[model samples]
Target chain A: MRPIPPWPRLRRGLEHDYTILTVREDIVADPRTGQEHPRVRIDCGDWVNVIAVTREDQLVLIRQYRFGISAVTLEVPGGIVDPGEDPALAAARELEEETGYVAGRVVALGSVHPNPALQGNRCHSYLALDCVKAHEGHPDAGEDIRVELHPREAIPRLILEGSITHSLVVVAFYLEHLRATAPR
Target chain B: MRPIPPWPRLRRGLEHDYTILTVREDIVADPRTGQEHPRVRIDCGDWVNVIAVTREDQLVLIRQYRFGISAVTLEVPGGIVDPGEDPALAAARELEEETGYVAGRVVALGSVHPNPALQGNRCHSYLALDCVKAHEGHPDAGEDIRVELHPREAIPRLILEGSITHSLVVVAFYLEHLRATAPR
Candidate 1:
């Protein structure tokens, strides 16, 4: 017989000072045995990712400093969604801020949780189309964000060589594929 | 006028260690403006995410405690990849470890640098199909992972509502879409 799914009960867990990442203790009902078992949990800050495509139809990607991952990443332009801000607007703002590029049309690509197991926040990804050069990007204090553009078709080959290996960028590329082929 | 792109630099800046998150830094060149920036980088453990399906063609998913957010999360079956392991092999191991159901086949969906800027390591996602019930799942010492299966069409809807929000999961879904439509 198939085991019944777990039912969570956080009867007790610890909290940490850093708000972005946290861990907890909890329980779940095992599907095979139908019993509760102890487990640890983790959470991370919510973030936003944007797919900024220029007028020539090239993807506008940025290599920005991520405090979590120290390496400057060559990725789609985006940032954290401030409290009470709509994600769509956040996407547009991030695109402009990171690339000095604005969208003539903005499309909601979709949203995804970076790591649901440990983080509570959602990272909504947006696709900005018909983009035009807005201004030169100005990263935050001490930030050194550089921008680049890649032809749409070159992404798959890049993935094979692991050049465009940033997880979010890969997601953005796959989303681009879905948008092209998905039936409305 | 458009800003000229900075030449991509593969250089290191100042480095340090932070106890707060047990992170090591490898300050890299901020490609945006060509400045020396002290970026905080860390080597996070590797991770695995799966795109598993049942005999009925429903997508396999799981929900468990996320200590960071102090909430329950519905997510894809996944785990940390042991050091020196191929991501595709790790993904298959996670599917069976968390779900107890064995798949007839496992394919590399794709890989993503979930958080490249600061964190080290990669997240390998995979597609597992033609599954059958195995023995009870064997979770880690403190894990209480629960498994569930959802219809294929339901995925996109869940994504919008923030239910199915894991970044790796979202990417895996889109990859599945691409494989489904590409010319065979």
Candidate 2:
């Protein structure tokens, strides 16, 4: 691997605040050219995606209308991690809040930048196994979410067939699948 | 699933422009509350991710410093899809430009929203098999990228062990792996 060059940030400022997302502009000195260039960065808070698996080996999923794409997308239960909240706790909270499921065990899958090229936030993924419906789902006021459960074996098929299209959600399931199938 | 609600956009305007990304604000009527809300949208062009595989069964990967995170990341060959350029063509072009590898076959794996909650662009993923290095890589003026190749078999381990942590890149490889193992 090549050494990481110094990308010096000359200045940064919040350009716009839209509650959920803040747009920031940064002037950085490009390592390759030694010239300053302005770049836009979206500062969305850290998010959590939970692959909650039921005792029956089913995956707790959600179908919701994404306003950006204006389409109902099937994805794993997840949401933004509230300020100062632990990612694992956020995962558990989102799973229960979005699907009414409680996980017996919450394990970290991994975290990744949703889009390193532009967005400045980490999306932490988790595997919540042995989930059970403990209460009625209580989605946020703006969220019209439908909870669904599917056999865990059907996830790959769903992804391949284009049913699950959220990149971070797909990654959460992929990590869970890898851990489940790894040779001991 | 509930019928898709009408998310009527009342107004939209560019909030800021920073070369690579343009920030736009949209006033839309919230479906659940019937109240207008201001949302920031990052207007990045559609991007492409390529899983370029050599005849020797190696995956072409790149190491680059991401300015937003200020960390070196190991990701598959990819870049922004030029305006009016086909995603497949952009995938092939990015592979060649970033790694000097040309694929014999370029197949669409899938497309996903980088951040459905905010970003308004799709990232098209592709599988480029039987790739061969035909020329030297030509990274852009600001990009200092290093190309590397790894055995295809090591991809799952790399992903599971957290070597490859870019969400979109992981999704691209996951789709490829699923397609390769699916029932014919």
Candidate 3:
């Protein structure tokens, strides 16, 4: 397979900052041709998602309204990873804050770039086993979330029926499935 | 579960057009509180991804350099759906354009918003069965892609090993898995 050579960045500058994400424009020289073009990149901070499995073998999920699509989506616990913060810590913090669930063990599932075509960030997925409700959830003012628990086996069916349509949440479940089936 | 009310859009305007995606800012009023805030939304065109399964039970895949992440990614054949074009047609066109393969039957898997929290578009996944090489591939100027075929059953392992990390492509496969396993 012929690998495409990396483009040489001629110049880059920040275009906009929207708190959650920042946009940047870059002038890069195409390797095949010396010509240059301007490309825009969205810098969404690296994020984390946790599949919190309770001692009863249920998965903790959240249903919240997302403004962009204006739909209340059923999803797993997730949030942005703060700068200089470990992704696992962010996963644990988000899970607790969104569902008031704490896991005894947080194992790494895997990571994926949410949208490598335009977004510059990775989403790390973790499996939080033996989770239990530690306290009442404390969601931020902008976030109005309701938590739900489902048997682990029902996840694939939920995904198929579109009860959970978030792509990253689906990825987290896919990783969990792999981890469960993989020989130790 | 308590469903959060959708925020009211007080005002909206296009902030930036980056050719591939347009960034828009919207002033939204909180449903509970009467406060408004400016939030950014990315308007990317609807996209299509095809899971092309050949007569030999092989999956047609592509490896290409993605500028946003600066990495060559293994992914399913996909591209933006042209304005006024059907997503199924776009899936067929992209499969042939990227891998020179044609399918006897192209079935709709389902659609999911790539990132509904910030992006306003849906990605439709398709199952192209009995695929065969129709002609030589025709990649666009900016696209440097190489095609590869893998045994259909090897897909889950590919995804588990981080070889296929594109979230949407993984979603396509997940949909295909559901389509295969669902009671028809």
Candidate 1 docking classification: acceptable
Which is the leading candidate under lDDT?
3
Candidate 3 structure quality by residue, lDDT tens digits, B1-184 = 4557888899986688778888888888888887887778988789999999999998899988787898889899999999999999999999999989999999999888888788778999999989999887898766778889999888878888889988898888888877777777
The full ranking of all candidates by TM-score, starting with the best, is 3, 2, 1
Which digits, one per residue and each the tens of the lDDT, describe model 2 over residues A1-184? Answer: 3477868889986667777887778888887678987766777789999999899998888888776776778999898999999999999999999889999999998888887777778999999989999997898766777888898889888988878888899888888778878888
lDDT of 2 at B63: 90
Worst 10 residues of 2 chain A by lDDT: A1-10
Better candidate number, 2 or 3, judged by TM-score: 3
In the range B78-183, model 2's lDDT, one tens digit per residue, is: 9999999999999999999988889999999888887776776888999998999998788777777888889888888888787888899998988887887999
- Please give me the DockQ of candidate 1 compared with the native complex: 0.36
- As a whole number from 0 to 100, the lDDT of residue B96 in candidate 2 is 93
TM-score of the first chain alone, every candidate = 0.83, 0.93, 0.94
By the lDDT metric, which is better: model 2 or model 3?
3
